[model samples]
Target: MRRLTAAVAASLLPGLMVIAIAGLPVPAGAAEPYDAYADEACDGYFDPLLLERGSRCSGSRERSCPTVRHWTPRRVSRQLPACEGVAQAAHPLHAERIQSSYLALRPDHGAPRAIYLMLHWHRATAHEAVNYLHLQDLARSRGALVIVPDVPGNQWAQSGSRNINQHVAWVDAVLADAQRRYGTGNLPVYLVGLSNGAAMAMHYACARADRIDAVMPVALPMYRSDLAACSFSQSIGYVQVHGDSDRFVPYRGNLWFASAEQVYARMRRNMDCVDAGAKAARLESPLTPVDIRYGDGCVGGRRGYLLRVENAGHTWPDMETLSGRDRNPYGLIARNFDATLQGYDLLQLAAGR
Candidate 1:
């Protein structure tokens, strides 16, 4: 649960580039799994070394290497349950005039192993349901009962309405409704969020830590100083993702919230990690693309992770071409790797699955 031997980590930078007398990029076809398109399309080309270590290439000439490997048809097919389609639903919240909506997605064919709640970013005024289906799709392959909810009135609960008390109550109602229809008696619940929604997930994990088994928050930080009401009474494994180059959520800790590193440090403390004794693991790519720091001697089956994607923006670090989303107007998404699976696998580790 602590150390993830990611395939790339196992590969260990095969065949170090011994430069020619005249300094230049290594000659073409110099390695076994050659980077087919180093100059123009290297970022897009799929690398098996990135996802699973022993997955032999299917040898399909039609395959595109533009994206990373975790979501590959073969590996994903093996990792997730047999799911050909997603079941959708919309249930009313509270039954009063003050209403909330949610989308429920189940695997095409099997009993789910767990329940995953994916919260979307603040919508402001975007009430359209279609704007949030992508959130369900992001977690569809995980073979969980995925519930994606829309924050009523483009907000996760009024800010001054006694903080998370209102938000947590609303969440409990939504989950209870979803479970009545598709309940799998006491399954571990995993929460995922992005941007503002990430803050909500963090607050939920803190306020109601007992109810949550694990949480994955991407690109958002909370004001730790203000969260005295929140408690980590239970050991909860958290896998957080953030871009150092994020423009919207500054990587640097502000007066309001703790920075990404600060959050990880706090996680280590909660998980009982040795003080400042964390060890960093990396995939030796150009500029050290992936850095995973292990919190040594974490007690109570708890895990803490920090996936620092270099040069990544405020968007999720997924392939833009396949996902067809430039979430940010600036098109600053970091597509060189798959951050989704990185966090997903970490959640699995945290849950002891």
Candidate 2:
């Protein structure tokens, strides 16, 4: 599983831009076929690529692209198995009550190939995450179980956040519940997040690397606090996608968050990867090609990649439009690359498929 042929790698990421990392060969893996929206008919007006973004095909009088049906998400709510905290004086064992509902999306049929955990950004809900990433459709297509939990107050815990221990415990409980219910035996778990949620993903991935095989954190940098606290014992593959123009979570360091360079350095330290320089991957639109950089020869066959979306903002990259509730107030959206698809592809590579 050390190397993948170019043809094989290309098959996994159909119609997307790619450039090989310097000196590092692509890992062996095949993307599970994603056809959840394959049946929606593409009209003459819109390109077929918009389907993955969960956009309804808006075509003209003449049909041009292939027909497909979008898999509408049915938001299912469930209570996570309770996590116990340190015993109090009167109560020997206390079950931490989770008042918020978590969302789960399962394949229509068959056992899941893997489990995907998605963390939404600050001030965002689980449902908004579904619409923003369209991961529900990915779940349906890949026969994967996707779980999204609503963090307390729509904010994930950070170093300054209250109940940090409790928040981590709740996340562990959610993974346990999802594994028992939908995970195939020994399924590889992948974690993906946006903004503050991205920071949380980095935190949790290092804290509980045994549970997560890889992580994709989009639109935010690693927090200085998180870097101080994180120490990875296992190889949890790391991939970051950030827009350099993101004002809300600046690619450069703000008061709290570290710069993109700092984050990448930390990831390299965690995985023990040697220097792999920037490689340009041109997309359909040459004006906004993604700049890819990574570390190679990481410990335990791991890798870390940072995708710098040119001139992009806080919004998810390369999508046609965001739903009203999912719009980002901070930055401009890049229309050249698909962040969701790129994240997923990177996740699979990290997991060794």
Residue-by-residue lDDT tens digits, candidate 2, 11-35: 1211111111122122246354323
Which window of 10 residues has the lowest lDDT sum in candidate 2? Answer: 83-92
Model 2 residue 304 CA deviation in Å: 1.2
List, residue by residue over 1-353, the lDDT tens digit for candidate 1: 11122211211211111111221233366444433223332232223233334322211122221231223333321122222355555666763334777767676677777777776655421212122223334334556677777666555542234545777777777777777778665878888876666777877887777777888888774665634444586877778887777655567765455778878777667656565555555433332155556553566666677777665555555422223433334224443445443455567666545
Best candidate, lDDT: 2
State candidate 1's TM-score: 0.69
